[model samples]
Target: MLSPEADAPLRAAAMTWLTVRSNDGADPLPRHELESFHFEGERVPLIDRQRGIRKPAILEAALSIITVYRAEGTTRPYEDGTGSDGLIRYKWRGLDPDHAENRALRVAMERRLPLIWFVGVAPGWFQPVFPVYVAGEEPQLNQFALAVDEVFGLVEPETHLEAQLRRYVERVTKQRLHQPVFRSTVLRAYTGRCAVCALAHRDLLDAAHIVPDSHERGEASVRNGLALCKLHHSAFDNRYLGVTPDLTVHIRQDILEEQDGPTLLHGLQRRHGQKLMVLPGPRSQYPSKELLEITYRRFLEPA
Candidate 1:
């Protein structure tokens, strides 16, 4: 059922399918139409459009894996070109192209010697098939094969596939999973101003997640974060400080009475209370009001 010789074309088709499917605000092609499409080069027809939506079994399976990976925020699909009415080309970019996983994908596709490891998807919604290789002396069939098969089985069966795939694409392309990058973006967006102190300082700034990273259901994104200085980030994380939806800073009353808390109390309470920081452009991307409400409640309670 599997042929190494067929791997290259299959992989190309699959990548193309995945790219088109993940495009935001775009319509997918009917499977029937996809079957009739022709691929350039290679005398053997890559897809049998005459079969009328009965795509190659392997192609369907490969699509499922691509969908899942896109959902996991590991990669992103982008439009490569546009010309034909209501049609578009697509491509993919992984977070770390130099990583072994991406390299393996390149080799399996037989793209080129020291292959670029990336490709563009043609117009259409049909799923594409590709080959996968497992490195081992004994051919570890269970791990590699089972993983691929599981993805294949999920292609059209999952109810939330579209929504999950969208979120995943944004996550991967934006590098949301990389905390440092996420943090830095938020900080840069705020121009290094502390959300609490309103003091702009390049050296002391940090991007703080309103909901701690551990509590974030998905990758830490700008939507769930804020820009704070080192002192404020630590204070906020420790529940010694909080911020309101209006961006006002709140220092816990109990901590203010401590014998050694004068410096913190004076610096935060007298100087910064009720004063709001100037948020960067696009308030929509700022920490959500709902998230701030939850964070404030936790900050007010006993730690």
Candidate 2:
């Protein structure tokens, strides 16, 4: 095992390599980009296709953890580590605590080393969350706690502060975990097109929530989301645009009547009272009409 002092540089280089490839997590990395990291004229793999945990021979601790995605119709091969307590519960590779993979993750926890989490957004497509730490282990449960940041890594699970920390962690989890998955899932259901304007550029589109995420009924699922381009997303969130239960788009009456630039004229005013340009192929994946009615009612309220 490499000493902690010796491992620091390698870890930094690996993180730098990952940052460049992922564009700091704004873009998903393909399998090839995630396959390996270059260090000192040698190639070190970042993940293992057959295993969830990966530990390079040269590193003293685990390098990364992966969560594979099973397509909508298929059964998952393993239980995914989406923790209920706002921290990830990564299962042991097998029943053996002495197993090399499990030991590597344990070493990561003991040493406070940061690791990467590669979550499958789609088949062969991954969204990377890096610098995560193995916070604590639950031997009875055969799992380890994975924290997104240093503060969370230090807190013991189920402490007196647990409730407060959980609330904080939940907020962080929504940003660091939920949103990326939510976006990818929603866009896939809509076939990567904006519902309102049918913009096909994936990067420019957003997964918008029909019932605001703060609401008690808000769910981060495809049925609660609409794929919209950036402009339409902003408009919908601001009540400048609204969509009824029947999937008809409406721009606010005052905005529709205002004389503005071509963008306002063609993009907003022209789209008033039109049906959504695109929708999910499966009826089940369509945005919930009930949720749409809730937001539309809010949109209709005096602004």
Q: What TM-score does each of the candidates earn?
A: 0.45, 0.86
lDDT of 2 by residue, 226-286 (tens): 9999999999999999999999999999998899899999889999989999998778777
lDDT score for residue 119 of model 1: 18
lDDT of 1: 0.45
Location of the lowest summed lDDT over 10 successive residues in candidate 2: 150-159
How much is 66 displaced in model 1, in angstroms?
17
Top candidate (TM-score): 2
In model 1, residue pairs whose N, Cα or C atoms come closer than 3 Å (at least 3 residues apart or on different chains), thus clashing, are 10-129, 11-130, 13-128, 14-128, 35-49, 36-49
Q: How high is the CA lDDT of each candidate model?
A: 0.45, 0.82
C-alpha RMSD of each candidate structure in angstroms: 15.6, 2.9
- Give the residue spans of candidate 2 off by over 4 A: 1-6, 73-75, 81-85, 162-164, 188-192, 200-203, 280-284
Q: Write the per-residue lDDT of candidate 1 for residues 120-208, one digit (tens) a residue.
A: 12123322332212111112211121112212233221134465653443333333123434554566557668766667866677778
